[model samples]
Target: MTARPVIALDAMGGDSGPAAVIAGAELARERYPKLLFRFYGDETAIRAELARAPRVGAEAVVVHTATQVLGTDKPSQVIRRGRGTSMGLAIEAVKAGEAQALVSAGNTGALMSMAYLALRTMEGINRPALAALLPTLKNDSVVLDLGANVECDAENLIQFAVMGAAFARVVLGVERPRVALLNIGEEELKGTEELKEAAMLLRAVDLPMRFEGFVEGDKIGQGNVDVIVTDGFSGNIALKTAEGTGKLVTGLLAEAFKTSWLTRLGYLLSRGALRALRAHLDPNAHNGAVLLGLNGIVVKSHGGASVRGIANAIGVAHDLVVADVARKISDDLANFHAHRPAAVDLTSAK
Candidate 1:
């Protein structure tokens, strides 16, 4: 019999508290019937919520009490006082090998800091980066450094590209995923020195991925590349801009449909297409953001995620654990470094 993979959840994290957390776990339990869950939070509150969720079987869940970590808690403050906090305990579970992965809808900075401290960076990795799936016109693309390291060097960008490619292969099942560096223009001479240097290194490497050269901001949503690599500063800004645009378009569509009876009739007639559009554009559908290059799996759900969104975040963690993503990334890194030419080291570039 196969051992059921365990997931540690921060039950007291997030805006909706334990109730939504438990409800989301129920959704995950239904999707993965053999999964085991470790709930870390106020034991009494967790139990109360779980009791109301008959679908989240008691046999499948273990509850552990924690002092709770507030969303506003600074990363440094939390680290200094986070021993028994829900987020800390969940991460500890993963570090202790009691759980294969940990999921939290808490402060992003706090989660990243604690995960980095507890799990550390994987072997051969300098820093852990935040990576997530973004909906695109052609297909879903993976983007990295969503909000981790605001400033990065050539080596950092190269690492991000490799991690993003691996993520795309595992998550999107893309064979030899096309990797592209986000740049101001598609020209080789365009953009910052770090980007140009990173591109040069990628071009010289004989890795398992294809370096598709440079991709502009507008081409990101066009799905021209399977992976878009950029520094955290640029990646986060692009992500927020895309999210806002999606919302604006959605709002405009709703207003248009409500503006006239004919449009309402048209909406009714195009309900199927509209539903598909909504699903494709919904951020909740892509709720989980992963911290790659860590020794243990860590998934961050949106602080204000809905039940469906939380469930999806749990799903991402589960898949990463099952896929042995950390191991794959380590293996890929090892292969690349072993075969890379001696002249390609750009680690010290500013």
Candidate 2:
């Protein structure tokens, strides 16, 4: 890790374009005073936003590019003809060692495709998983395979656990984080043969994490586990459901509070508590989702994220770079393979 880490930004990404991207960079700069930036986008638009944020402008170097990835662009299309685009150039900065990490609010599929193609997966990692921090009752829990690998085998799940545990150590400040597989029921035999085999292998290994048996959907918010492992199919659905439920609850509360004068008075009295709840439920607070197992770091911010949310996403990139999370993951994976149990054959298990 360097004293000052430079982040590559796809300045033309997201719904608000350079305005939100530059504003977010300014906020991130305030949080991390030693951070620097390389902004890639239309020079005129990027410079226009930078003018309003003198502090960030002083620390940023703009690279002009008229091309930008669209929300509707397919990953295959980007892979074939995206090198000149802002997103592609930003990713290239990381691969070329000019930037420590890349942050983009562009299309998720496109970003993943570009990153995987440019950076490739780390050695010993068969696939890269999308991991994010989810707010929980005790603290934030790391959930992986959010939308990267739809189908996974026992070996893939085990690898996700190792990578996810490394992420928790760096981001969540948890030592020997507890890990579990997401399944329909808590019973040992409830999930598929792949999951049960993965659990058995995890239990047998002497890894840096504590392998909790299993976790159900209802228990995700309980915060009993530090890392939750699942295939992208299940993990993505769980993430979307949680987001929808949060909005539903907040909307219902707003309507109830506006029903009558008595309720209005009650709302005024509970304003402080409501504000606290709002902060917890804010998606911006947990904006950055990393594509783990890549040689270089790549963080995906929500396209519709606000300035604060985008800043938080940048903050995630900064922290991961400073902590040297990629190296930690590499080291852990090496340790796992070196000490792998001779009796367990991943091929046979699969």
Candidate 3:
């Protein structure tokens, strides 16, 4: 653990191109002085941005030239013949043991495809899920399958629960994290057949988490639960809804503050609190979306994330790598299989 972590960067993938990636790496170095980086993209452009930050120039950053992948490229196409692209080479660095993790602010589907194809899934994972840390009333909670697999059966849902619980344990440091399935109502009779079946499966297994039956949509941000599990179709919708609502509330507050001189004075009086609120609701603060269940760590940042946002994404990758999340997931799955009731068939109901 004493050795510095090396992060591979896909410098040419995002909306802002290599400039934002380089700037973000510079900012990350300030926080992690010993952190190393491998910049995969056009060397000339990477160097140009590197020159802009003197402090970063002094750090250990190796430039690796790569053919850029366009946003218009499809996942299927990328998986077949995009190995030489910046995103592809970044993932290759992790697979080749050259870097601890890979971070990209690029096309979500393409990143997932490349990561899966390159690093492959962990032992027990059928498919990797997209997980995001959502801000809640009490604290942030982990939500999975943000947009990875649209359709999931009972077995897939159960796997997501285990993965999500491990994520909360590592990232949130909850000893016995509370895991819940997202449903229409809290009652056992509610939800589709898949939800009910998944619930039955979780209850039968002696997993490390506390499986709290079912949680409704409104409770997602309450922080009463540490992890929320759902299909990608539902999880993705909920994520976008929450993000949109946050932006709407922020805009309303800003407009309200500018309404009158008295309101403006009130805003001035509450400047400190407002600053705290801004920081709390900042999308950039939670820019990293982790691709779970993969053998190697892959973090996807928003395509339009700012410099600080990109730095935050890097921090997510760094934390997951340090926590050895993949190994923990493997261990947990091993326990699940060993402790599961003999009559219970995990392959059933799917």
Clashes of each: 0, 0, 0
Q: Which residue pairs clash within candidate 1?
A: none
Q: Identify the runs in model 1 with alpha carbons over 4 angstroms from their true place.
A: 61-63, 344-350
What candidate 3 gets wrong by more than 4 Å, as runs, is 54-63, 344-350
For each candidate, the alpha-carbon lDDT, in order, equals 0.87, 0.93, 0.88
* Model 3 agreement with the true structure over 1-350: per-residue lDDT tens digits: 52788899999978998899889988988887778888888888888888897666766465566577788989988888888888989999999999989999988999998899889988889989999899998889999999999999877898899999988887888988899999999987788888988897788777779999899999998999999999999999999999999989889989999999999999999999988888887889888999999888999999999999999998888888878888788888898878776654434434
- Candidate 1 lDDT over 1-350, as tens digits, reads 22688899999889998888889999998998877888888888888888887777576455576577887788989999886889999999999998999899988999999999999998788888999999999999999899899999988898888888888888889878999999999988688888988898888877768889999999999997899999999999999999999999989999999988999999999999989999999888999999999888899999999999999999998888787777778877887787766774444432
Positional deviation of 33 in candidate 3, in angstroms?
Answer: 2.9
TM-score leader: 2
TM-score for all predictions?
0.94, 0.96, 0.93
Q: lDDT of model 2 at residue 234? A: 96
Ranking by TM-score: 2, 1, 3
TM-score of 1: 0.94
Best by lDDT: 2
Candidate 2 TM-score versus the reference: 0.96
